[model samples]
Target: MQISRTTLAVLVVWLAAVAAWLVVAKPDMKTVQILAGEMAPATMSADGELPQRPPADADWRPLDQRVLAGWRDPYWLRWRSTAPAVQGGADRALRFSLRGASRLYWNGRPLAGNGIVGRTVAEERPGRLDIVRVLPPSAGAGTDELVVLASSQHQGLRLLSADAFAVVAPAELLYGQAMLPWLIAAFATGALAAAYLYFLAVQRGRRRRPGARLLLALCAVGLALPMVEGWRALVGYAYPWHGPRLFVLLGLHMAAAMLLPAYLARHFGLSVPMGVRIAYPATLVAVAAFMPGFDARSAAVLLLSLLASAGLLLRVQGAQEERGPILALVLAGALAMAVAHSAFLDGPYFLLLAILMGFLLLRHAAHLRALDRHNAKLREERAQLSLQLLQRGIHPHWLMNTLTCLQELIEQAPPRASRLVESLAEQFDRLRDSSTRQSVSLEDELALCRSHLDIVGLASDHPLSLQVEADDTRLSLPPGILHAQIENALTHAGTGACAQHPFRLRVRRDNDRWTLELRSARGSAPHRGRGTGTRYIEASLATAYPDGWRFVQGVDGADWCGRIELTCAS
Candidate 1:
């Protein structure tokens, strides 16, 4: 499938985020070679020295786990593990990452200490958490000895381990470890910013879709994942917090696993079965619990969530257009997780979430735009229907009044009846011609009004006449707008009253506006509120101008007047 603009835009955002990370973190690519599986417990040491060997009674524990505990003062930790055979003349080093001040030794040969190890906080000088010592060529392929004189007297938090002490391939390897956290943190920061923008977009839209809730939830997890992944770099916590950190990280991943499917369900407007809701997270937890390591567990949870969402989407009926993009994204996420299984949580996982959330935001924006357009079209159609209804209303009332006048005149004066019939026929012809048009020139509207008045004059004893003083007659307005006003004036103002004062129409130009005023004498009849004529006038004005038009009609001194203001054409 072709990539959408939104998806491409999302990709651009993700790339920008990655670029920002690279600029800030400047990470090294070199990899560290962990030496052994375990290290002996640390014991208090008075003098900083390379031990002949680890004590016989020392308790051995896994290197990757808590290797030192219950100690507040200075101590020595030792490790003896087979080193990878160094190629002749190849550069190699010992990498140490520790929380406190430390001095180190390799194979009984003294090396530069990270910082001074002291018995008390007053004398303790904290060291760089990560340091490297180049290994001598004579250091053979057999078992290598490593000893660290470590002190935590300067540290405020009680840590369980002294961090990692391992045989690194080169100096760059130590730099990589030091920079990894920052790199992850930078990526997380960018993703976090993107998520915040996505949330703002959700808030700014006119129509908030159900998918918005899911997009927000995705953003929430997008927020948490980076924090969990880059916590070490962002916070600089001691080693003691590592276990709790992992627990929290794992907990977040589990929550995300549960949330992703729900998010997808909400996003696509699909109703998820209760079985899957219960089974999916349960399966995620079950699989994650058996994973070999925290990274594997995290990856498993994310990958499974994506696959499950894909499966759910597959069953969605009649929504192929909606289903395709999200399906592709979830599948891509699953594939990315599978490929980056080992380091998914480190940085790749954050990148994946950014891409997914970005695409969702883009799609949501597109959906909202489409919704707005649809609503606008609906409003336009409804306005057109109303205008048509008003247009249709005028014919019946005008025809009925003319026929009544013709019948009366036929009996009273046959010659006058013939003239009224001719005027009626001419008015009908004008109406038929203007019926198909949305708007007509003011000149044509005046002709129709004159014809209408001729019929009224021939039929009534007190005939009505129209007087027009227009600055320009070519100005366009909705068909029959002024004609309806005249009819209303003759009906409510009374033909007898109009016969005395005469009906007046004056059109003038002022700046960018054209003002038309209709003046007539009001009859001594009870005041009637706005009627069908006023509605027609307003609806026609709205349909014609949509904006920049005004209508007002009420008593003005001795006469009844109606005013229409139309914006001039640019």
Candidate 2:
């Protein structure tokens, strides 16, 4: 695929955004754990008051587990840990999660309260699942103390599990809260690219190439799969909806299996019978619908779905001995993808391909724009050339000369007069045909040159001879090029100096270059001005051979010679 300017711009912008995000949102992180809540204060000062003096080691109970799990009654935990030494003066924070209401105290002083930590079940309030409480710079260092008075909700004898509490800086939690927003932004962008590519494919309709639309469609579908799979933290939906999220993921996975095979069949010309096609997607849907209940063995459903998708692709690929150039690019791209997968172990490979597919779509759009411009230019040039051809044939000078010659020939020889008129008409017809074409075969162009010579030969006082020596008549050249050269020769050659003069046109191919040489009698000055035959030939050659061509014209001894060498496609 071509790398377009737009692709470069997008990459640059993405990199810049990443750089800016890193610079502005630099992580000031220090990880320090102060909580292994295993506590029941031996002496309580009062219900709503702190102990005047900190409790001794003998007053607290130390358990094996860090969290206060399987505990249903209201309890107060005075979590204490010696302050870890600070380095680099990094900013500190206290982050924790709990199930029930809680109030926090730093160094035995009342600080922040979340909901209401109550002694009785009736008075209890539920706390948030997650919390981040920043510690002041004056209090972050040395001998820190936190008091979390938590009450677990009692549902008969069942104990509600509570998340452990800890103190750490935001940045220390690497793929923690900060990562969610980035993932969301990345997936949102992928969705946009997918929609745009699909729109392009649909807008192009029948003009869209095989596999182009399928590639984009697969990319769009594949990108959303990871978002659905990771919605737990990425979207932060309610935990109770876990079953529905899993269902959505399985459904998407099944859809991908169908689409992947369908792309292979459509793009690689796999002869999938109608029955097989219908059965394939049907099987995927059934598998999705009947996925095993969530358990250790339930992972087999996803593994099986992957097997089906890959199985279809391999089956189709094996049937064909021939593959397209695009298939080779796909393989090469997959190889690159493998390398990246190794490097970015946690990267969502499917969504990454969406980024690549976006670039491909841009390249396709650029290609289409270039082709459209070229076609429009050709149409314009054809219209202009057609008008020029009409005027050339209807020129009053040539018509009057031909008619006058025919009148003289009628009195002298009627049969010759009829021949002259027929040749004139044939030459006019060839000119009209040549005018409509950008290129013509050497044979057809030579025929036009010969007809013109015949008509001109009849009207000239000095006889004109024509000689064409070409090894290959299969080659194509710009239309009217040879004719224009011959016209220039007739207008300026002989000069009544030579008794007899012949116009010569020679063509041959040497290696990869096609050579055409036109030689007329040498003269002191050029016969035509810049805007006439000379300019037309130059313009036509430039348009046809923008590069890889040589045009040399000068007087060689007694001949005014011009040679054009054009490079052929490799």
Best candidate, lDDT:
1
How high is each candidate's TM-score? 0.52, 0.42
Best TM-score goes to which candidate?
A: 1
User: lDDT of all the models against the reference?
Assistant: 0.68, 0.57
Candidate 2: which stretches are off by over 4 Å?
1-15, 21-29, 32-382, 413-415, 461-466, 469-471, 494-499, 510-512, 524-529, 542-552, 567-570
Question: In model 1, how large is the Cα lDDT of residue 563?
Answer: 91
Task: Report the poorest 10 consecutive residues by lDDT, candidate 2.
Answer: 341-350
User: Would you give me the overall lDDT of model 2?
Assistant: 0.57
- Candidate 2, RMSD to the unseen true structure: 16.8
The local lDDT score (0 to 100) that residue 364 gets in candidate 2 is 50
Clashes of each: 0, 0
Candidate 1: segments with Cα more than 4 A from true spot: 1-34, 41-76, 80-94, 97-103, 106-144, 149-165, 176-192, 195-199, 202-205, 233-235, 282-293, 318-322, 335-342, 386-570
Worst 10 residues of 1 by lDDT: 23-32
What value does the lDDT take at residue 264 in candidate 1?
A: 74
Task: Give per-residue CA lDDT, model 2, range 1-570, as digits (tens).
Answer: 344454455555444443443443345443545555555532445675433444565346653233455554556666665555353334556766555566777666765766665556677665654566766544445656676666655323222233355655533453465564455446546655665665475447323434556766666665665566455445443222444655565555455545555665665566767897777667655655564443211233333433444444555543222222223323433443344432221233333334444544554565556645664575566456546645865679868987898899889878778778888889888887888787898889888887877776665544566687888767777787777777666666643432265777788877777888888777555544343666567666655654446767777888878788887642
